[model samples]
Target: MPDKPRVILDSKQLELTINRLCYQLIENHDDFANSAIVGLQPRGVYVSKRIHEELAKMTGNKNIRHGALDATFFRDDFRTRETPRIPDVTELNFNVENLKVILVDDVLFTGRSVRASMDALLAFGRPQLVELLVLIDRRYTRHLPIMPNYTGKMVNTSLSERVSVEWKETEGKDCVKLHTVKK
Candidate 1:
């Protein structure tokens, strides 16, 4: 564990970023008319809801499906942790087959979590396409080639640093921060 760093995106900035991201998703895919938002659990879930709210206001439609996914079992580092936590339930009522899926996450770090999320998502159904939406794209040492399709910000960092994304739903605040381990 390491001491957290200074705040990056404050509450106001985070809201603006979320709105921009939702708008970008709509603009990127003209067929967002039939797309679904699937948030990777924990922070991603909160981001999905916020984006969904913005989308509803922009599109004037409230039918877009928002779902949550937990990738604990799918993670490659599951064995590394002494006590593996139980995975949260994945709930997506709509069929994902042939539907565009926007996988949302708070931060894009090592890409291992995104990879695990993909593995978990496959159990639901094969989607037509899966696009990643991340609030902070911290470009550190990546083990995989995974990249985010929609990014609010890109921060170059060292391997010893950590990016933290906080949302009101979970953290009682909306902000993004970068933490570095003190040597």
Candidate 2:
């Protein structure tokens, strides 16, 4: 049987969190005139898309640049993984040079993903500033030094636990769950 999932953020709460994150983004990058939002591909895109939509609505700037970044090749343990790694599509088409880039992701785990994302982003262009935005921040589990500039939730999880974020656009609903393996 599958392990029971502990509810972290339900649909209502998820919407609130997204809205809050969007407001926070607006607070920092007012009109996004000199900024862009890039979602770390695969899962981050879901969260990023929501933020992009809401922020655009809030700022009335539909021209705000949004892109997708795939960091599979940039991961440190790509070759070490038992399963073969397949890279996702990268759809960045704007110049990131001298702009403030916000990197959005679904879950902040070991900080390795953020590190790989930074490396991947550098290939596009050198930004004046880079900030992180995550739906869930898994605290005390980072292997590298990294933190999110805007966070929806802060969860303290054990090494054996897993944090999964589901979005309505893809998962049929929005929710954050903590899954513990059955012992």
Candidate 3:
């Protein structure tokens, strides 16, 4: 049988983590004058939107450049998956050329999404810098050499487990959970 879901971050804890992440982003990208936050499409948008909103509230930069990227087609496994994938809308209104960019996502699983995001981002324009921000970083499972510059939490998991970030926007709550798959 599958293991019961484990709560990694509750609502209050999730809020605190996000607050701390926003401050960290501010510390590194002061003024955010030339930096943009791009949320990976699908699930990552929830975390990115929240981060963008928090950053605006804390930095008072109501004009922060935040956009969503859909890397469905850019994924390396796009042609290998048995199920077809539907593409999401990409709405990056600002140019990333010569700018610093932070890629945001709810969870960093195998790093494939991040890789695809980077590839998808290139179509916009080459940014001066590229960093990653994730609500949950699942260690030891990365197939690619990718890591988050800003992470809310780092978790160690096995191949039989999965970590997911739930947002109130879509899941009715803000929490992180780890699920175990039956072998």
Candidate 4:
């Protein structure tokens, strides 16, 4: 097993960020009533669910659609790994054709994952627009120009540093961490 990294965003900050993001999403989109939140599997899924719940509370309606997307197969580096993990099925019950789709993720790193996610999402249906929402935006060496429309926070770090996001679905905790690999 590999060594885990350091802790960055604690429980308090995580909750605060989520609330702020929820408000931002509501404020930015005038037609949020017809919007759908799609979370990238693993951490993104959890974050999306939380936001969905918050939106429902604020709007006093439970019609918000939440979807989970797994983009492992769509990754450009998929074939490079010796043993790649099989991707989970992408589940978007509603048609994305003319609806607003919000893509949620835990961390924004090289932007490769976001790029791959977009490719995977296109297979479902062409949406009117797609916005990115990320918990932590660690601006490092980005190969693509992808940017998050709703970002919780921005942290600067070296190429060797890593940002880990943990949620109840996977880690049974809600927090974000920053760690550096041992040289």
Worst 10 residues of 2 by lDDT: 165-174
Off by over 4 Å in 1: 1-4
Q: What is the TM-score of each candidate against the true structure?
A: 0.92, 0.96, 0.97, 0.91
For candidate 4, the per-residue lDDT at 181 reads: 79
Model 2 segments beyond 4 Å from truth? none
Candidate 2's residue-wise lDDT over 1-183, tens digit each? 448999999999999999999988888888889999999989999999998988878888899999999998899997788997889999998999999999999999999989999999999889999999999999989998898999999999988899999877777888999999865
Best by TM-score: 3
Local error of candidate 2 at 48, Å?
Answer: 0.4
| Clashes per candidate, residues 3 or more apart or on different chains | 0, 0, 0, 1
Ten consecutive residues with minimal summed lDDT in candidate 3? 72-81
RMSD of each: 1.8, 1.2, 1.0, 2.1
- Clash total of candidate 2: 0
For candidate 3, give the lDDT of residue 87: 96
Instruction: Report, for every candidate in turn, its global Cα lDDT versus the true structure.
Output: 0.86, 0.92, 0.92, 0.86
- Which model, 1 or 3, shows the larger TM-score? 3
lDDT of 3 by residue, 86-145 (tens): 999999999999999999998888998899899999998889999999999989999999
The residue pairs in collision within model 3 are none
Candidate 1 lDDT over 31-146, as tens digits, reads 46678999998678878888988998888888888899899888887778898878887888888888899999988888988999998888888998999999889886678999
Question: What are the clashing pairs of model 4?
Answer: 8-177
